[model samples]
Target chain A: MEVIALKKLKVFLAIASSALILGGCGLGNLSSRPSSNNGTQLTGHANNSNYQSVIKHGHYLTSKSRGVDVQQDANQLNLKSFENGLLDLSKKEFPTNKYIFQEGQHISTKTTEHWLDRKSQNSQGLNPSGKETKVPLYLQQMDEQDFLTQHGKHLKLSGMTVGLGINSIYYYKKKKYGPTYKKSISNATVKAEGHKIGAKVLARLRRKPGLKHIPIVIGLYRQGSDDSLVGGNFFAYSVNKGSSIDGWKPIDERNYVFPSNSGDKGKHANDANDFSNFKSRVQNFFPNLSGVTAQAHYINGSLSGMHVNITTQFYSQTEIIAFTQYLQTAAKKYLPSGMPIDITVKSTEGVQSFLARKSGSKSFSAHVFNSY
Target chain B: MEVIALKKLKVFLAIASSALILGGCGLGNLSSRPSSNNGTQLTGHANNSNYQSVIKHGHYLTSKSRGVDVQQDANQLNLKSFENGLLDLSKKEFPTNKYIFQEGQHISTKTTEHWLDRKSQNSQGLNPSGKETKVPLYLQQMDEQDFLTQHGKHLKLSGMTVGLGINSIYYYKKKKYGPTYKKSISNATVKAEGHKIGAKVLARLRRKPGLKHIPIVIGLYRQGSDDSLVGGNFFAYSVNKGSSIDGWKPIDERNYVFPSNSGDKGKHANDANDFSNFKSRVQNFFPNLSGVTAQAHYINGSLSGMHVNITTQFYSQTEIIAFTQYLQTAAKKYLPSGMPIDITVKSTEGVQSFLARKSGSKSFSAHVFNSY
Candidate 1:
């Protein structure tokens, strides 16, 4: 349910670009921070309590960092993917049942702001400076989430994650309210700069007494532009050893917008066709459909999940229920297996029905909203 | 507008009871608070940047208190009305152009917790002492908003508003996993106790150094039960001078669920018939509608706004556009004048279209969501 709620928060866009990294929070000057006890903190949560709450988001204390991501990124989809994708990756290391999670407290807001700026005489920024057209500061924003372990009455920090949001296209102006120029960041350059920044980040962070030895997982994310339909993806990440990251693991995550003529769907041609068949089946079953669309996800060029959205002309709960039931049949017949897929039905009024099928589930579960 | 966004945040309920108060934040132990510079602060905004951002909702600095009300009051609709209605009432006195608003920062969480508890054992709650069901605590939660004015480069607190959320029905359990009992709070008791609590709150708040001389507006709110279809409303509020709330003004706010069989229709019979006629016209024009419903808001027993939701069975955008046009005509012919009304058209997918017309506007403006 939280997955769907978070999905609603992202702005619907068209397909764009991506690249990657993921990491969490580490130790900080504990006394300088505000009390972290404002929200409901949980330890050893029930196995089935996977739902997200502000205090504990599936074993992570989220610190209510919901809206700040878009401040620099300017793309809602990029913000969602950057935040949620990093969490998904963090789970591989910090198992929900084995460890507790909290928002990054060690990395101060000032630190992130300073890190994003281009290096200058007055500031120590991560991005290379004095070459505006050459370097063009790719790093936009950074977020940290800390993993902790229970030690008596206190939860001791064990590991952390760091997400680096890089710009796919840089926009700048020579004067205030003047015409803005754009520069596209190539995949090769993004990878190079992102790695350079990550290495420097590790070296600087290692000097802090609290962060000296703890491993840090850094993720490099290439952001989508404001008009982009698809959110950016994590391209590369490195699981560290002591103060050094031995190697960067290539994270090949891709998205295909359904009903596309985009030629890049080479290996994913079958997945695209399957999505097309699913859309047609649902549309054929309900001829009154206004429009049907989907954004399919793939990992290493293999299908993983599909999120479908349908907008309708009617405001009927009974119709929504019947259509959703029919959709489950179409999805089972035409969609990929081994991962969860979801569909949302809507009319001019609002969300009418939601259907989702988990990987292990045989059938889809549906919810039809009551309209009074 | 923020009005509709706030409405969506509320859970759809089936007529609920309500009551009132409204206020804002003032000065605190200034030095101890976190830096309020995290958000994009605006001093004198444009004539119309009415859309809501996390840092600012309309002219108010929201402090991201979006999901906290349900912590104390389980009903989501009550949370929306309790927060938004307080701002609406405060706007009458504060006026957006002259004063800027921010979330209540002065009343610490600890203060509100102590204030809401039933008076006893290390608690100085406003609610009276242990009499069990005979004197159940009515006070649920309190929120404040601060209004500020620019004084050269500095912004000074000009005044404040406070909102009191009261329980309409109290539910409690004696032991863990035990049967829960409900106690109904009568209007007479709600009024007497609310007034008494309001006066005491003023007396206590005036003692704080930062609050002594400033004017305060308090709105008393009655929260609806979880299953109620309609949101709660503010029943009464008072404008204070110095330490005293001069005289309370009864805010006669009411909501009517259309096509109800409940005999309370009386004088509203004609208005009800008008609504039914409008529904019939739309249904006759488009036989595929799933359902049409309206929540008519009245101030001083006169219709001020009608939020109509029509769910449809068709997923056709063309049909939605045409039906919305037909709806505009029907609305103009049947609905009351001098107040803004909005209609949302949705199916199971999500919001398909939104149609709204300001009070002075003669026709409704429509938006059809892009299905892709």
Candidate 2:
């Protein structure tokens, strides 16, 4: 069952986000099913020929226990329908999660924007500057397979996962923008949240029982900015009839996030400036000031908040206020949008804190920092 | 605290193998330690700032019970020495397994040749003919960490793992050969063997416990052939003093073979050909001829033996003998050497089996397949 092994590799690679696209290597195709040299589907592989090593490795449950047909061809035949059924079932189970097919789904502008927001939140670090592309990602059916071995006496185990492709989102984003759209968030958070959502999906899918003894697995996958499946996370569910949905045991889930698309632009282009860069940028405003330091807090990838400390030889309260105002304006000029910036101005007498950020409108807001 | 999250991510990324090298990414460097702005290492991190999220995620144990210095810098200071100690300890324990260091160790030419032989066996498909760089990877102390929470009143658990960078092997093969090499062994088998050795190492480490309640974990890692580390298998160990080493519980181990390397040259070259490809290659040699199929058995990464089934349309005994001889030569041509290749030329009349492999010296031997 090299195919089974490939299936496992595919799953693992998909989950590990950083796995190179297994294509282009002379090692044959890994993403799709293993094909014969002549390009024909291996429809009639001998029993366990494709899975013997995997079985020996104890990664898959055998069909020997029951009269189940775990043949690849047979499974492939039902894979689509089963996945669709699972997707529909998932939608029915957790509609708030916004599950949908990568194709054949129409969403509202609000829904798209919400996904964009989540996507932005998921991203971290600096992104290329361009037009903002607002792409919506939704849940869609993905690959499935039987388990390495049977469950209990009458139970058979099979599982499938889902993916969130950004192809359509990219299309939407590109269409909304001119050539490209600045992805608001960093690439790192998208991966972290993708894995979380995947596990969450798996936990949710555990409750749905279309087949007896076959435990279901659910996960989240996202296409890289390149439209390749670069990020995914998955979990397997063990069934318990008497227990609640939460009682289902989740198998090992990958914690790593896959890389996003290469060409994908982000909304926050200046995200490259972290604590260090911000410190220097702030220093540029006060060239002669010797003691100036900045600490930026990155929640996902973007700066959520920052603390800038500056020491001056001497300054009165009014002078400090004026300097703080000028600094607020200057800080706003360089910092990424929506981030809270706190400035600590220190004198020989005392230290004062100024909090600066965007107000409800386009105006900037600055005030004295309070303990609360 | 978020730095701790970054630390966990770094550890997980490093451990997962296939996890993208978080280098150059805006997500912050994860593998070593987190340095502050101006490239100065952040020394005075707040309590729980490094381990809070990891503890919340239940990934590591806090050193609350015993006075264990679980801080990254302290741990790092001991990392190289600790790893060296473990490697020496492992070598002393499992002499037959032949563990060597990537550097700073002298071994005999025989040992180097033995490793080269094993390395050749581990490699399959088309190995470009060239000078072989025989590097014997010895036991070296590797990444270690404190365990996930304390086990009991006195037991403070800690563990370590080793990685064999197959990047060199992949490079040697790619330079000597073309794009592909026959990967005779299954990823599953490689994974199984890796865990077995990992457990063996753990068992050996358990014998030298300086502390009664301190449990040690051991495992192996290989960067994927694509150097993406997408294919990584790992196992965790839980120690009990009274029980036999085998009795020790092994946490779940991944059953995926880390790819050799990919086009990233030594780092990203796709290494996908395994036992399945060998089987397929053998199968392809007899595609049009019905009843002509072969089964190749691999141990670790070498071909141990093969079972070839041949059905005759019309052939004499002499013809059968020639076909068997040709098949053996072809098998030898593709499969890793020093292993036996068995061919069973069958017909409706009777079955004739032939086994071919290298003999004591330059001679090759052939015999009828027998039970003995």
Candidate 3:
């Protein structure tokens, strides 16, 4: 009886040990089991052991690993291997390095620019100056799609300005100045009117959709030997986004100190030597305008910042009627809901109010509906 | 004299020992030293003794000094340290793996039928039963791009023989197959009048300076009804660099097999049951066309591949000429230099001859050129 009991006990113990081992192996129906950091048992052919090992190794490196070892591994992997491993690791970890990869770094701008310059220099094996020719075939190939695909997302069109110029003038004499003096004065006024015309032409671009986004810059320079401001020339372009604009902030004392003329010896210049104070002031009136700064210098005459000023003048009676009708038609076409057109004339003196009514005929004239 | 000599010998030995010890320290002169697996050493900052010791201890699980125990240090460093160390070692041994990271893995299909089925099912929010109202949008997009970009690179037409019904026969006998049919048949006959059309077309494509290098592929499909052949359709496209006839071989087979329906009952029948004979003939003529395989079947018709056969024969000759001309003109305009046009044609007696001429003048027929 004693021998039988001992044999039974041994058998029971053996079975219990076997069960424990199986449980540890995760094959037994037990709740508690050791988790493997690198290896685990799974059922079926779908459980790819090699793939699991790779995943486990990757996890081990990223979470429990240090940067020093990672750097070492990065060094160890060949270009292809490192790229593959990084890609695999990234999938299980970050999944995408787009956030980490610097934008615009993949495109080598210097190389592209250099190639463009070389092509330009060759001028399709034509003359050195590349003048009086059709656009380069290579450039023609660079349609909107090519530009957009290559640089659209990375491009930031900031701080750009346009330049204005005039070659001739028109003028009217004022009765306040005497008749004998009026002749010489009228001549000067005519020349200045030409420059004003140029300025007005440039100003009209503000209404054009494509040009509206670009800041208009004005610079006054002599074209031949004209004393009138109307005969001056101007130039323009956008400022690079990387530069600081704190100096060009609109403030009382520094209002006239536009940041232009980048390549000029004068202060606040643009690289192209085209930016000026007049351009900056006109650009400022545009509500949507941003990133405009300029520099200015007197070419053939002296004009202090105070003397160089702009005054908003009111429309004449004839002009008022034409503009009112134009506005009404435009409003009707663009604004179906309706809009308000306030015709107020502002001058250096003060403000005047009048009601502008459209004449029914094609040739319309404006009469003062009311006066104030 | 003996004492002086002993002193000199001792000094020399001391200097040699010091040099060996300094070299073993791993902190060589920074300015002239080469970069290690870790990184480049900065000038005047070569005293990286601590870093070197840590790296060595991490790698070997032992200390550099004779008496120091490093097992505890190794344990404290953990998996991160091991990973970093391993990475460093790898970098020293394998540098190429650093840049080429894997983006991701994808399950790709060699044939379009599975893609179409899966796509259709997905679009309808249910598993497809082999019959769908229309091809999926994504499939359409792919097909559009393939048609445009891979024109001459793969077969793009289907062929079949049509039996005229009694009513249709009477209509054709009276009105010459109606106005559209009359115009189309005349155009086809005119285009196919000379055998040199193919060669001239090839030469014209070669003459295109911009398309000198592009590889052209022409796909041919036969029209048949009850195993009786009719007219054929030919289309062309170009391939991008590095992709060759090898890449499109399967597509050609798929094109013929999927577009016809004759052998639907044999034990070897598959989705491509209809055009088995056509495919075999295609393979025979253009052995390299083995890769141009596709699987097609008719869902509603009593006979497989029957609809395509009737459609091909129903179209008039003028329509075929117009279609071929459109494809050739597109190729002439867009492809690069040196591209060959792959031509596929189907006829009642197989592709005996086909004619094509440049639009406007019958004098310049493609059949007159024979460099092929």
Candidate 4:
């Protein structure tokens, strides 16, 4: 029995030695690996204790494209929203409580940059050729965040989520510090192209050895233009469990800006009417208000959320308190219930008060900035 | 008021005409003049406005009494003055940079609680009797911050500062979850009672085993209620030398919520014209602004220091750099320059850049949090 045990130990040591030798000559796959990273497989990466602890910074892992993506990202708001919103979607599928977040080690930054390039002789670009004036650039940036589950002492990759930041308007200069030219892409074209790219990308990603069996979520975002105040929203998404994506799920999202300006309130008539009535009530209470505007969000043609921005002429704390209390009453009386609504009243100086309600909650809580 | 403004305008015009001839070659220093400070002593317990390197947390400390005093110091904010404001009263007698900050060792949490309770049987309470409804439970919370100066082998208490959190309005319910009944205290009575309490607390603290001669500062604060959007300010403070109370010095600290809505022509001829003018100039120069607001600190009605928070609409580093530069010029042009003026520009995600001028400095210094 002792001799057999010694033999078994010897055999195990031999296997480990051979594996180490192969790993030592890791340069064999170096060319295929990502920059700044050792090309560590998602399953083979170091265990991250962050997921088990309180998630303060966020659950999303730092990708190889983190820095470059921000630099190439279209605008400030979209740049932030792209990764954050993607994390929000991924968390819904793979919660932080159950899974650990890891950067997508499978795809190299060079590979993503290649896919983001124009389809030239040497580049396998995801964007259109220079001849296609209408769609100057569709794919702005690609981000990947992997979710892993702890299995004993090792971390096993549970799933991966991909974010595609597609551009609405591509602004480019013919030369450095030269006149700028822009070409806009329609939302329909962006959606169609995004779906096509998702399937192709899924097929390509599945070809990678470690990713064949895991689930993948691909969120397609309509990135904001340079002049857009707010970031764009995810227009569609696709989730595939085993190797291939079967079909895409189009997200029915719409934002009704300043509903009072819309002549035909459309299917969002109730939301538009409610928002308009709330604005009027506020205006009636405080005629000194500079303006009261709102953007109501709809999902599947149903009101999901609304954000009201109130620019006020009053600066006193008493006035702010009175108005906030009055606004809360007005919101409850005029605005639709059962949806999250946020309102911020501001003087030219800055935000004076903030009022909001949680989804399905009856009452709205308000805070007025203590003014002196 | 019109006559005063006319006379002031005549004086301002006279200064402006002469300033153009001499100031063109004489640095073009054109911000508003401070109101009453004819350059006071730093050692004198006046307001200091130098702590604006870090931003984002509101100007006041979020208390933790289940959202009350020092209890809820759950996170961060470095905005509070050290060798300035009410602290300067203590700090002038005890230089802070020479000592190390540590939690107070002498006072236990239970002891402070006893002192906060109403004077009653089985309790050594410091508050006035519950029978006096007019001044009932005026002392709400107490905070202790200690500084230790390193001695040869051990640390010795260099100084101690006690914050008296007095209630402006006493809100209570007869039973748990019952309707709250509020008993408001007049400022005059609060001041009288707070001064009386300060002497007793100082005498009690001085009797502690090791706190004999070390300077102790007692700051009487008028705390805001649960309904107040902003936290209360320290109104008066007394700096003691050796176990005794000196005369209380009033803190004429006023925080103007950036600019008032005194828009160009004031309804009541608002005196916040300088700030409004500055805001308008910055807004007009850079149309891409989310909003800009400030909390300008004044001591004895003089602009001692100003903290301006600029929220940008764009996300580009180049635009931020340009805006910061433009803002620096605007700050020098529109704001009072003699004070420690600070400004932080932020996107919704986080801070992007900050610009500041140390008190008595002629030029501004700036830094960007991220290059991209």
lDDT score for residue B233 of model 1: 75
Off by over 4 Å in 4: A1-61, A67-75, A95-97, A102-111, A131-135, A173-181, A207-209, A224-226, A369-372, B1-372
Give the per-residue Cα lDDT of candidate 2 at B100: 12
* lDDT, residue B201, candidate 1: 84
Q: Against the true structure, what is model 2's DockQ? A: 0.01
Cα displacement (angstroms), candidate 3, residue A320, comes to 52
lDDT of 2 by residue, A233-293 (tens): 2223322232223343332322111121234344222443333454554443333345765
lDDT agreement of model 1 with the native: 0.61
* Clash count, one per candidate: 72, 64, 103, 5
By TM-score, the best candidate is 1
lDDT of 3 by residue, B1-372 (tens): 000011001111112211111111132211222222222110111121101101110011111111111111112112111222222222232232211101001112222223323433444211123432221111100010000111222111111011000000001122434441111223233223211222222343345343345433322111111121221221112222222221221112111234334545442254344234334432322211223333222222221221111112211121223223322322232212121222223333122112222223322111100000
The true-versus-predicted C-alpha distance at residue B366 of model 3, in Å, is 49
Interface RMSD of each: 24.0, 28.0, 41.2, 19.8
lDDT of 4 by residue, A76-122 (tens): 66765566557667877887667756655677878877888778623
Q: Write the number of the candidate with greater lDDT, choosing between 2 and 3.
A: 2
TM-score of chain B of 3: 0.18
Q: Tell me the tens digit of each residue's lDDT in model 4 across B80-153.
A: 22112334444555564465434344677668767776786326688766554344677766756566554442
Kindly list the per-residue Cα lDDT of model 2 for residues B243-280, writing each as its tens digit. Answer: 13344233232222222223323211222344334445
Tens digit per residue, CA lDDT, model 1, B339-364: 78778787765466666777788766
The TM-scores, one per candidate, come to 0.46, 0.21, 0.13, 0.45
Over 4 Å off, model 2:
A1-372, B1-50, B53-142, B147-171, B174-184, B187-192, B199-213, B220-223, B227-231, B235-372
